[model samples]
Target: MPFKNDERELTSAIQAIQRDPTLRLYAVAKTYSVDHRKLARRLHGMQPRRDIIANSRKLSNLEESVLVQHILNLAAKGFPPRMSIVEDMANRLLATRDALRVGLRWALNFRAKCEDPEVIRSWFELVQNTIAKYGINNADIYNFDETGFMMGVISTAIVVTSLDGRAKAKTVSQTPNNPIKAMSQSTFIKTRIPRHQNSSPTSIYAAVNQFTKGASQIMHQLALLKAENQNLRQANEVLSKRRRAKKTRLRQGGSLSQQDAQDLQDERDVVQQVEQEIRASGGRKPREETRARRCGKCGGTKHNARTCQIEIDTSEEEGSE
Candidate 1:
């Protein structure tokens, strides 16, 4: 029979047998609900089939992780990739290593890993945290309903509405060329109209809505202003502390600290270098220092053989010749 329990249960069963000498394999297997034979095989140092399959997979662990992350990122951005896209991505990654392409339905097996309970839970947590972080309101969130029509059959229809009536505007279907053709279905596009101002309920609701909106806006603005003020105060405190420290250091006959002085000097040097580069007329780079010329005869720097001050020993050269 196929292994009934997962690798973890089987491993636990094997460990249980090993830990207690008196424990029988069947008893431990029964406790973990794993096949006794599989447990025995694992105890004998035989690796699980799952591990073997994982080792034989086309993508390595790290590559698979990267692919999963990429898929998740696309999903978070409201553009979930299709199974074919996943297959193509896997093939691209494999191609980088000059490996053979994955087989058909490889994406199905890959999707199984991403569909784990833990992974799904994490996805929900991520969305929840994001919503909470942004303080999103339920009223501000909207649901989208998508509809499609036959491309050639759809014709532009005029939408008419009365200014005072409560009737909704709708699309009108055009007559088809063939008399036998059935008339296409009409589509309704609802347009919101203001209720009668004389209605007490409507007027009360409008007033309440206006007041709530204004209050919410005021609260939001206050929150923003409070945060900005806090930041500015923090910045001011930092600047004041720095100024005091600088004065104290100056009174002690010291300028900036060693590291600070070095950083300032480096900043000045970078600014000077940038200024020089910017002021340069052409696209030419800064001129490099010229290498000093050496005299071949006298072996002296800054002068070549033609400009050497030392006189040559012509007598020895003539005798040798």
Candidate 2:
């Protein structure tokens, strides 16, 4: 019967061989409960058969290395991508190479292998040490941090309205007026409402009788205003409930709003575009046309020294001497 040996067992067998150079392979294998042939292969520094490794991925070593580099670059750019985003990028790369499609398991394994916790901790320590040595302040650190272009871009606007249509007109407007001017106009309109003794019911009744021609019109307007005020109160209550629910959802990291979802999608698209640009550039920087001039003689990044008249004159003087 064929036996299976785990990494720990194999490692123990290798350690036994290292500790006792004169130890036989069969003895080491027996001690570690592994195969004698596997121990012999390990002692001979032979790699295991790739086809027999169940956890071996479909992506080639070179392709996996490139993907890992791409992921690290993105993380350094302050866009620590999600697994879904990584999977999408991987799928695109695989499709181009006509490789097998990757699943969630593959993505999980890729992350586990590429982003080892110990390696990440070492990188963190290095960064912390560098920061301490430089005595960098928060502002300087922020300047160095790479952020998305749409970091603070507005995604939505909220407009409150009442069913009775009066507040609706005030809330939703198309007039291209300055916000301050519009707000002042709204304040002026609000201030016109009676607040003193004139606002009393008895006073209003006396005024209605005195202005006989406008009595019916004034009563009708009062009825409409009362209905509008009731509608506004209800609308305010609904808005308050919605605000509370939104806050609760935000605290729990629940589903996003339509605008927020759209913004995230836009950011993902921007990242994809950047990745495509990087790929198209062949992983090398695009040469600057303005700084293309270089010295042909010494291969320096300055002026061409080969056809210089000054050098020609100096050469002629030396020849004459």
Strongest candidate by TM-score? 1
Error of 1 at 161 (Å): 46
C-alpha-based local distance difference test score of model 1: 0.59
Best by lDDT: 1
Model 1 TM-score on a 0 to 1 scale: 0.27
lDDT of 2 by residue, 1-321 (tens): 355668778877798778888988777777777888877777788766653534546665445544554555555555555666556656656665477788765654563233579976986687688779977665545523222122333323211111122211226432223546446545543454455445546544443343432333333334434544676799999988876776677689898889866755786789887876786589554435435877766566655786645678878999999
Candidate lDDT values, in order: 0.59, 0.58
Off by over 4 Å in 2: 1-56, 112-321
Clashing pairs in 1: none
Could you estimate the TM-score for every candidate? Answer: 0.27, 0.24
Q: Residue 103: error of model 1 in Å?
A: 56
- Residue range with the least summed lDDT across 10 consecutive positions in model 1: 183-192
Candidate 1: list runs displaced more than 4 Å. 1-198, 207-211, 236-256, 281-321
Model 2: pairs clashing at backbone N, Cα or C within 3 Å: none
lDDT of 1 by residue, 1-321 (tens): 345668778767777777896998878877888888778788889986756755448976546645665565556555556666667777766766688999896875564233579877886787578669987665444330111122232213211112222322255423222223222111111111244446546544554454444444334334434544676799999988876776677689886888766755786799988876775656655643334556899877877887665555675677789
